[model samples]
Target: MSTYRLFDRRFIRHLAVLVSATVLCFSAAAQNVLRVATEGTYPPWSFKDAQGQLQGWDVDIANAICEKLKMKCEIAAQDWDGIIPGLLAQKYDAIVASMAITEERKKRVDFTNKYKSTISRFVAHKGTSPDVSPGALKGKTIGVQRGSIQAGYLTANYKDSDVKFYDTPQAAELDLVAGRVDYILGNMVTYYVGFMKRPEAKDFEFIGPNLQGGLLGDGNGIAVRKNSPELLAKLNGALAAIMADGTYDRITAKYFPFKLM
Candidate 1:
């Protein structure tokens, strides 16, 4: 071969190798691996099944978002109180635990547009007809999930009532069933699915008006660190895609009879 031709061929081979390596590097970087946090105790939203596997609306939604983004996702079970702190400390890339978009949380972490809207309600024994007004509920013990919007609402509006908080809604429901509380304040969907639908809850019914707005904020959204604008954008895009593609509705139908979005 001519000397010039031999050098040109060798240069082409080197360039091809470098280009392949660069493409592989970019591919690896593009494969986003995200660790998502959730309160595995919240049923219909996120919870553990009989086999100890994580499953629920929130888990399904997170998986769907990952699928839409063509990325790898890991769901990490974290305590509700620590979920936000964990995200702030880089323990998780995002939170999809049905966390409401409240002003207090906005001060700490940025939130994507709400994936689901929610409202709180008061539940009491059937035919009891307990007054729901702040004055009427005075000195009455109310059960609510700690750190939830119901707790905040009760604290802010029902000052005369004694509010007892539990780590999980199940515990508060237990208290209500045991007659330890006059009423249980919680999400309407949760009350309907987790309590009112159960055989044990047949004697109970929802009372008062649906409580929302103000301290409850707008709705439930995925939480991301304030500094992760790119991640936030990606999540928002994925959420929109799922909602538009009917995936969101399918998942909602699996857990709820009524629309939450």
Candidate 2:
């Protein structure tokens, strides 16, 4: 072969290999990663550990789902108020933030069947005894996480009460410990396992009946963008696979003493 033609062929071959590798890398990146968002402030459900790594039931479950789907999972913390918006904006592919499904939220997103069902409860300072009757609680200040289902329920039902909103349930619980709010309602498992078990929260106790159903929400599920039905179906299948293969129970027992499903 002539030197010029030989060099030209080698260059073309090298260029073709480079382009092929680049295309494979891009394809693998696009097809292999699953991005998940969680509220790191919500402990036992999802939270950062001492090392700032995301850990908790929701985190574990999300990992299991990704494993079952054979996807590389990336979990990031997002503020609770913006979790839904974050998914819609494509900041992440899904939310495993213990987001309870509600009709209003359904308009904006799709959800998998619940991974864990939780009861809601109202907490108050132990030293304080207040009537939990609707009329009595209506007159007392209530604390709630802003933008939560509990907040919506409280607002709709307790129109006469002073509602103090916090960015996180932990923050609201702190205010209750400080006597800032008469009572606060939230996920029972969150308060029972994450809050009431803490030494600082020794003065707090669950009051009122266990709350759920209606506007308070039935259970927590994974949230995906409304437009992403294929992704949603993949998540749902992965969720089911985890449930049937005993991975779900193993993860639940690692976090909670009781059955969560």
Candidate 3:
């Protein structure tokens, strides 16, 4: 072959190898990064502070998992209703939004083993206890966050009652304070810490039996898209590691007095 042609061929081969190496590097970097989504309005679990930084138990859990896996993570705030859709749409790689492991949810997405077991209950103005049973709930107005497990439970069981659906938990709380709703059903910790702990909630107290089992779900779990077994396995392993090393408990203590996991 002519020397000119030989030189050109070698140059082309070198360029191809360089391009391939660059692409491989980018893929590896992407694999090392974990993108997480949380409902920023949900306090003590995940919420944005005054400076808009994400904080709370769910945020801590996500950070710990990322640390144990040696993966850098980017957490973004999302609406509670959009969290699952965002994960499936690749807006984020996983959800650490205090979502429960319910059978209905299982059909849409796979979940890491539960990180926290939560109980649901009713909260109302103190001194006026209301029965939460289906029969007692008839003609009452119950406020709940839309697309939450408590919302689903109210829909399924309390058809006789007026269900006030709010896009955010804070909205439902505001209505409860205004006495627009008879009562609100949700996570006990969220009510006590996120809402009722405030001075405005001094008159409100938890009432009715602690709701769990059946439709309430197993517990809160990190959600990832279905068929992501490798990523799922990595997260679950990291979760187990954090719990064993006391990282999980320490984070919990900062936000909650008792163990959630």
Candidate whose TM-score is highest? 3
Q: Write the per-residue lDDT of candidate 3 for residues 1-261, one digit (tens) a residue.
A: 999999999999999999999999999999999999999888878888899899888888899999999999899999888889888999999999889899999999999998889799898889765567889878999999999999999999999999999998889999999999989899998887778878889989898888887789999899999999999999999999999999998998998877785
Candidates' TM-scores?
0.87, 0.88, 0.92
Better of 2 and 3 by lDDT: 3
On residues 131-154, what C-alpha lDDT tens digit does candidate 2 reach at each position?
676688767899999999999989
Candidate 3 CA-lDDT value: 0.90
TM-score of 3: 0.92
Model 1 Cα lDDT, one tens digit per residue, 72-150: 8899899887888899998988999999899988999999999999888899988766569998899999999888877
Predicted structure 2, TM vs. truth: 0.88
C-alpha-based local distance difference test score of model 1 = 0.90
Q: Which stretches of candidate 3 lie over 4 Å from their true place?
A: 1-19
Give each model's clash number: 0, 0, 0
Q: What's the true lDDT of residue 50 in model 1?
A: 93
